[model samples]
Target: MLNTGQNLRPGSQLFSSVSESNHAKGKYYLGNQQDGNLVIYPAGTIDADSSYWSTGTSNRGLLLTLSLDPNGTLWMFDGNTSFTKTLFLTNQSSGAAPAVENYYCLTLDADGVLRLYSHVFLRLEGKPTIKVAWQVPGDRCLVKGVCGPNSFCQLTMTGETSCSCLPGFEFLSTNQSTLGCWRTLPISGCVRSNNSSNEETRMMATMVEVKNTTWPENPYDALPVTTSIEDCKLLCLSDCACQISMFSDSYCSKQMVPIRYGRISGSNNTLFVKVYTYRAIQRKKIAGAGAMLISGATLVVLSLVVLSGSVFLICRHKRSLRYMRAPQLYDCKVDGDIGLQSYSFQDLDVATNGFTQELGRGAYGTVFKGVLANISKEIAVKRLEKMAEEGEREFHREVRAIARTHHRNLLHLLGFCKESMCHLLGYDYMPNGSLANILFNSDVRPSWSKRVAIALDVARGLHYLHEEIQNPIIHCDIKPENILIDRSGIAKIADFGLAKLLIGNQTNTLTGIRGTRGYLAPEWSKNTAITVKVDVYSYGIMLLEIISCKRSMELKRAGSEYNISEWAYECVMFGETKKVADDACIEEAELVRMLKVGIWCTQNMPVMRPAMKSVVMMMEGSKEVRQPPRPASFSQS
Candidate 1:
């Protein structure tokens, strides 16, 4: 196995061994054998069942060595010669490659999974941060023999895979559960017997029903009876040889031990496992007796307490009835799981300190910076000035959509307040303010690297809204003023007042001209149906602004007036792309790549522009950015 301090170099071989580390001993091994193949296996054994992943370079009958590059590329070469043949490779593409000082190594983790890890030294933290650069069988549950036979693999709420034994079964090795499990009680109903003594013992066996679970092992008997789930459960319980029964769509299958390939499934499959019921019966009897004793004592106490509180209860009921009969104030449809709190107008008024400290103003509302009295945490409260234009339903429809969205790059909606016609929204305060403040109004300009990161941040946020969610959202407005920077220097997309959600099977909507003039797509002026590409066009315009640190409409060079998109096209055409973002420290290739992406996005036609997903890939250097065609002379509609 590879060690913590060592990285696999060219012509090096890895042997299976136990090392002192945080991992459990004797569960994993990585071997770059004499053959060309590089494989991972369960420690102490090498078999079809124990092996999980390999480079698939084996069977070539040539000696191969594994090597990891600084860019997180893993490849194998044949023999130790200048003219070496490459066999297998995997690449991890990111914004930039890791530094030479960073430690990169491949390890067969304790969980029987293979991973390429990079330990980069953080200068400010004075310690190295470990990151997983690559991994095989990305879903850990897919690793063969990870949980072994008679046990199921499950993904917990925390996103980790765990092994769980079937009902009435226990782990064979508690310390290392991957070894599998065994039945706690001896098998009794394997063979049918007519003896009366055995009949009662068989009746004692009960079926434990579980939903959304499957054991894909071949069944000894498959019954295609179109019966209900209850009937299937009873059939498995009465069978002499059946250990587990799987039922789906009225089909029943009987499986014998040891059952293999059990996992939590998304389908509506029910698993019924036969378990020893003696212990369960005893526990239920004890619990029932205790419940009866407690109920008898509680009843006497409740009788006395009720007599004393009768008068108080009547008075409280009358008071509540009077309040319930009073006039209703407001009504707003809200989803319980939207992750937004419904605050009264009075509460927001107090939270914003009577709307005194103005943070900023937008097309829909004015934002105020305030510290919540209850939590003593700062918040940005936007009091919608034009709430009267759009009724309560429209305001809440936007709120519900915004609250349902969650991404690291997207702004989080904390809560909302509605009082009759008054409407307001609360958000986590962004201490660094909007991108407009940092770009045009600040004394010091941000570095090229930070600008590139911010552009990517906005692209990812837009991608989440456009493609990642169930109902795609078009952020009609994409501008610097709407992109806010948090305290940690991360940019978040905000202001969803003009955001439009495409309902089921609805790709485009006919809406009036929306968004700032310079950022709007040509479709807006043409009075055509609006799609997500409009946001892409706006993002493209903003991308150029982020690179040049200049506004789109106000861009000029050496006293010559030019649109920012037009100026960028001219720079790229004349082999002067360096002028777009002239930073001495940044790579020219990355700079040119971003310029091309921006140009492609700003194409006049909606179909000509690349989607946000493609833009993000090109900006992150994962996808090659080809040369873009010339944008229309009129960049904005």
Candidate 2:
């Protein structure tokens, strides 16, 4: 009886009291509880308590059922429904009502008891929890046909039970009075009708009318009929599907099922049982119409499938043409004297084995482990993200620089693919991945000397980008993800997709927010014109994060207690930098000096930070260093 809440759905359950589908028309549902209660409620959210109905029978063996009729009425019954309770679900101040468009379910237990539950998606527990709305006890008096047939139960003045037949009816079973009574005139000629006239058929139809009674029972069709009582009776007679018609409160319900009722002397309702001699003939006609409808629907579904398939093929062909044309814009067939080469999509697909063996995914696209056929060299293939004109300009800038720029401390771009809209870039594979992963994820920790060497190499690469080139290039994104390590554990700067080429004295690059969170420079937040100093600030943050093995972004503001940077600065000020150097195995003086230099680079004002050349000099111990003042960002605190 204990089930995960996710299994609850609209019109789904273990056992329903009625053999027919409950909540088939949607909106209403039922759930069987472990406590043996049968409940009926709306689906999707936790019980809104809008207007739910239930058979309040719990912990009573394993029999339960919660059912709903097409017309807003819900029933709670079990295998033994003689004493089961009935509830009408309508919107009111004192009841629960269902919301529109939600998943719901009803369950009947082995004991024949019924309960209703709604499906609620609450993820803190990582599964749904069932909310009970309504339940019904398997009260035996409520079971349909308990009094058997054509007979009603009566309580005598002495509190005894007795069964009696209607005026002209007789008992079907003499020994068992509850087995019900039958009509004095047997229903015949129903199967022998040979297309009789409407007048003759209506004349032969006999109505057994009983007032002050209605059964909370099964239905063949529960819908609005004419206000006139006689019209309601005639409507039931016309439809062969309907055997009995009940009218109460201005609505009519026609049913083919047996009617069961509790003894009531003053209900003021009407229940009519129509006996037609041609009922068997009408049933055959209905069955034939159903077969023809199914055949017509099948043909319509097949035609729609063919039409949709043709449209899909045409759209795919048009898409392929756009992809093929995108690569022709650049002359990719030409080879150059530059170190980098050009590749086609077909050539890369073979290299990466159809883009299999995925290394990982990034913010843009996927990276795969690949191998070149000509050189037989293992490489990393990056499928560049599709972009607009501005991004296309950036892609071209990266390609041109990779072709010309060559440095031992920089990652080598082997080639690029431009055969279609699929853009890819290939780079020499690094045995050791990024510094962040090496420091945080891997078992082999980077030694203090190795950390210092890595820092110097990264600075040299930045120095090459800032001062070495004729027109300096700004590597706007310089987080550890872009720092690749060679087989010898040498750090190399990579991922130049965010590189901006500077011409002459132009340092201002106006654009939207760029770089990742926790690593973005302060200038990005201000929307101010960016300079190489932005890279300096980012490098400073990266350097501090490397030293203490702590995150700079997680640090407190300058005056709000200790962040990694602030802690390192204060430690160095007190001649205790070695304490914050973590488990590094390096000379105390070098650790002290690196800590000082790291803190100085992260100063609030970009102008206060040193250039890449000065950073390299400070790490190499070739230049004099000065103690820094409290950072300007502290003023806010």
Candidate 3:
């Protein structure tokens, strides 16, 4: 029953009878009082009454003429050239044809009744039906002008307004113009409440729950429900500089700085302390009393074990250290002098759960999935299958080399484990498996753009290793199996066991062949001096594979040989480059650009090959492509 100005439309009629209470009728005008003009209707008699005239020509439609009575009877001047009305059951305008007009006026009375008036015609029948509705003009806010306390205002469709607190706050008052809200005090300054005793305050403060809050910056700082108040308090108390403690039944969070925008839920029952006294003596007394009896017996046993083990371990370690520290007599047995953090065998065993989950098997060792116990972070554990001399040398070399290097595109070494017959190296796990899985698997084929991205990622990673680093490293074994993909479809180079670090312009003196077949540089086959170009050639082949989405080698017949790189070379020379491209990458300009780079990298002469730096630049830079020259035996097949 609110008198909202709604549901009123122009061109409506209202009627009243003579029997209506306190009816006063002679001549009454039905028009807006706010306007000076009024239309008169005669109510008492049908005559040319001068009292109804208000200084206007009658022919121009009397501005104040009235000829209707409250008895539902009509009255008007009856003449040939004058306005006239006849008594009828209904009060209807009867006169010369009226001109069509658009203007109308409507008004509401004290009782919320609407009355309408139109210039063209006025008609009223028996008990005219009337309906009312409501409407809003524009948006409104709960706060008159400004927003809530320390809050901003927003308008609703119906013109209603509301408030929102700024960053690092909760709504403290409905009247937002005054004080807004307070932040939880820091743990270093936690104090007992002055309002009431701890017990009474805990009950009241717990009940005064903050409701419907959100942390604008770090949501993790929101108190979780899994942890207890005591546990939450202990966590906050342990960190002397903590600023806030949020706890739920399931979790607890402590912040070291001012808590940001967080809504207090209605159900929160945790206490927020500003600071508390450090009772170290009481804590020490409790700990000392509990451990006194057990400490003696445990210490006695531990001493005897330590005394015996220490002597034996000292001698064994001294011998092993001497052997490892000795000068290397062969190039293959090169010892990397990189100092890395060593992990205890027990630490790694606990991480991998005794190497239970086998991730993959390789010639050197079986890779297993492990978790770092201290951080609770997952990692890949490659446990080397102990062989005579080569495997042990490679294991030590890989750990030392990889641990010394750090790059975004390179896999990270989390830690390592060395046992009598098994050596394990922990690395960050790649969830999406390897590039081989993505390329060859029938279940999922990477889109052309994704393949181009993968190729660029791999190329950039190799370029970093080969050129960007102060001491460039050569990834001796670059192949599809070693190229791992992360969950986001990013490619990273792995398997640094055969990798060698180049200090200055020193070339890696290879004593034996070390690389995958079909991917080995042509110079490596001819016993040419190995350099970073070998890795570049291998990377080029891999790039071609990524662009083509095909294996380096495929069977043409039972006894025939077909190599993808060779076929691609033929296709390029014969001007049928599209035919050699991966069927999946067809019509993709990026793939074509990558293919051009790949061909340039795989040129027969090592010196003619672009440096990995140039390769990366060409892949990323928007430069024009150049036509490559046809080599001898371009289509040997």
lDDT scores in order: 0.73, 0.61, 0.52
For candidate 1, write residues 463-523 as lDDT tens digits.
7787555456777888999999999999999985344421221245565566787898888
Better of 2 and 3 by TM-score: 2
Candidate 3: regions farther than 4 A off: 1-341, 385-400, 500-506, 555-559, 573-575, 582-589, 631-637
Could you tell me how far off, in angstroms, the CA of residue 101 lies in candidate 2 after the best superposition? Answer: 91
Choose the strongest candidate by TM-score.
1
Q: Per-residue lDDT tens digits of candidate 3, residues 17-123?
A: 22334343212222211111222222211112211222132333322222333322333342334654432233344553354222233332221122333233324
Model 1: what TM-score? 0.52
Cα lDDT of candidate 3 equals 0.52
Q: What lDDT score is found at residue 567 in candidate 3? A: 63
- The estimated TM-scores of all candidates read 0.52, 0.46, 0.44
Q: Comparing candidate 2 with candidate 3, which one achieves the higher lDDT? A: 2
- Tell me the tens digit of each residue's lDDT in model 2 across 1-637: 2232333222233433333444233333345553445444322111212113444565455354544543334545556555454564623233334432223454543223344555555444446656655445434233333354556666567744567665346777788786666655433222222344332332245557878653554454676754678877877766654557878877888864324443444666787776544342232332587888997898899999999999999898787776665434446543344546778888889999999988766554678988988989999998866344434445565576655566668888888875446778888988788887887677776787787888889988887776544345677778777788999989998865334422211256566655666556666767567777777777877888787766665566554534456678778878787666657456787787787777777777564577776787778887666565555343212
